[model samples]
Target: METLYDSIRDKTRVFERTGVASFSETENGVQVLTDNGKRVEGSILVGADGISSTIRLPAKYRALVGTSRNQFVENPKLPFLARGHMHNVYYEGISGFCVQGVQGLVFWCLFFKEEAWPDPRPASKFTDADCESVITKYGHLRLGTHYTFSDLWQSRVNASMTVMEEGMIEAPWNRGRVVLLGDSVHKLLPLLRRSVSQLPSREELAEAFARYEAKQRPRANICISMSNLAMRFETQDSWWLRLARRLVPSIPEGAWMPFFVEYITSAPRLDFLARESPVGRAHDLKSR
Candidate 1:
């Protein structure tokens, strides 16, 4: 993210500490008035402002996310502390994913089911006490095979909790010269990338936005459903679910290949970027 920012900062005029006060469609483009009494004009407006997006979305889960000083880096002898791989650990009613990254930090998120919130849900800010409650409850869960959530929490460098919105907005994502993306339109529990390219006139932009939403909506829904299912599998206390969880690690790799293939092939690559040649059995399955 820092690399991308550095590359683009020279070309991009970024306004900091100011938010959209209001916006209107101009004859040739969109005009945005900022809270600081500044006006900015652009060919079109794209809202990528995250879960607390100015654009509306419904939320169904709350998550606590944090970064910890990597214990593996501190110890250097910890087993299975593989960088760039996610370790998902679960306890009843909570699902946690932790990753030891190459950057010498351990990032983690604990997501749990919550009552659904309507569009424009009230602002929720979780206190340090709330974070402590989480740590007190589920901190014993193992991250990978060696480290526990308690290990991460105790060594925490930073932490915050926020409500996670789910599902796509029911209203049109684009209006006149404006469009929305990411959590502004569809908010998935897990990480998903959303992108739009090209600049066009109002009519063409509207058509493009419609096409983009139509194609991406189903894919976003599937991702949301899968995330929800995963949360349920990790959190539910039902007997059959507990049995299934016990059996999951023993499930054969072949049983998962088809889903893996579909996920890989469904990824959309930018036309302007270089394409890699497809290889391996997944490519063979796709070709077939």
Candidate 2:
């Protein structure tokens, strides 16, 4: 993250200590106002500010619903249990829980289905009592043989609960000279570990945004659907679903290895820049 910040600062003109208050499109370009009442004009405005992006708010992009929380704890045995010092460990349950080891601390999350917390309030509106109540309900579950959710909750120094909104801004991501990018354009379930790729070069901005939407939208939608399906399979109490889940892990690895390899190899790729020699197309052509 620091490397990304440094690269942006070194390569681009940056505004420091300035917050965007609002934006408007003009005949020549886009006009922006800073929180302190200063006006700045530019040919293009890129909104990469993340899920609560001020830019996306004006564009009518909103979160429908989700509940998430992150907590940290000390787990000395984690390095040994996770070979090669694997950082992320996810456990499937009625809802999914994840433990990520980073910088000598274990960061974990509890994801609840929308129905679990249907209040529709912003995550910030949830109080410590609310957080504690939810944690207590699931605290008895074991993360592994030795660690339980209770252990992490008791040791937590800080935590937050948030609603994960899922949606996409309809095409023509740019209106006049103002455009959107990253979480501003689309948001997905966090467990998927997906994100919008790099922006196109300035010279190709217009064409690039169009291509980005066309290429990314289909794959993003597929991932969102898969995530929703996985959540339901893991969280729902339906007898058939639970039975299927139990049986899935019991299947021999050899039974699914070929299909798994095919799926991974055929996963989508983003084409932000032209390639001198594309490698995957010939294999795809031969298979076809």
Candidate 3:
């Protein structure tokens, strides 16, 4: 993990006190303002600016990003709350979202089909009461009477920065002293698992990414495509599927440990990878 800037600074804060108002690039490198108007130079500029990355734009990112695209949106106001009604409607053209808050709060989530919704629009522009009118047409979920609308009515301007989908390049990333990392490299895909470690070193980071796109893209897309081809599955409605999901005990036995292996035993894949690499000599002795 990269060290935070504060640790390297003197006991007194080292930042220019004022925040950067603008960013400019020159032969020296990317420059940001200091409270004192001094310029700071960075050798390898890291753009951790997040999903709305200014680093990525129409120029170098011409083929990469290039356009504003809508991805997902949720309305804050849910007139009728249905707890755990959120279904990842894989069947319909769009993904369906439903949530029921514990208190009086009601929230709604939905995924529009690919190229379904346009971007650069404020997300919160529509209030929940307004959304009720839109969602009521979908199904017989009985959302019309299922909510506590009064307490949730404490509201304000309904609008948001519309999220957009990004186009990935066949060979999109540039490599050198300067390269993008984290969300910059990969479009902000939701995490696979909380246990999965995301930190990739600059080198392993770049190589592993290309390796992921090359090797994993096929399987990953296939899973989503299969789900896309399927239908919106309501657990209560889908008896068997819902039963399996509910009864699925994530007993960590077979998954974390391989079949027919000793309790304190070594992992086959781990042993193999370590053996093929310089690190395997250590594992060989341990397994013996």
Model 3 alpha-carbon drift over 4 Å, by segment: 1-40, 47-49, 54-95, 113-167, 188-288
Model 1 Cα lDDT, one tens digit per residue, 1-288: 344457775554777657899999988888999998999998888876643454433445667789987765466555344677788876666778888775767788877655443233433545787778767766777766777777777778899877654456778777777888766766632222333544566887787778877777777877777766665676653567767877989989899978967876776545455657655565456567
lDDT of 2 by residue, 150-254 (tens): 666676656666554455666666644455666665663111122343433444555655566666677677655655555556454356776786688789999
Candidate order, lDDT descending: 1, 2, 3
TM-score of each: 0.63, 0.55, 0.36
Q: Rank the candidates by TM-score, best first.
A: 1, 2, 3
What are the lDDT figures for the candidates, one per model? Answer: 0.69, 0.54, 0.36
**Comparing 1 and 2 by TM-score, which wins?**
1
TM-score for model 1? 0.63
Candidate whose TM-score is highest = 1
After best superposition, candidate 3 residue 248: deviation in angstroms? 17
Candidate with more favorable, higher lDDT: 2 or 3: 2
Candidate 2 residue runs with Cα over 4 Å from true position? 1-21, 51-93, 96-109, 114-131, 141-148, 155-166, 170-172, 187-205, 237-240, 254-263, 266-288
User: What ranges in model 1 sit over 4 Å off?
Assistant: 1-12, 51-90, 95-130, 140-148, 155-165, 187-200, 237-251, 275-285
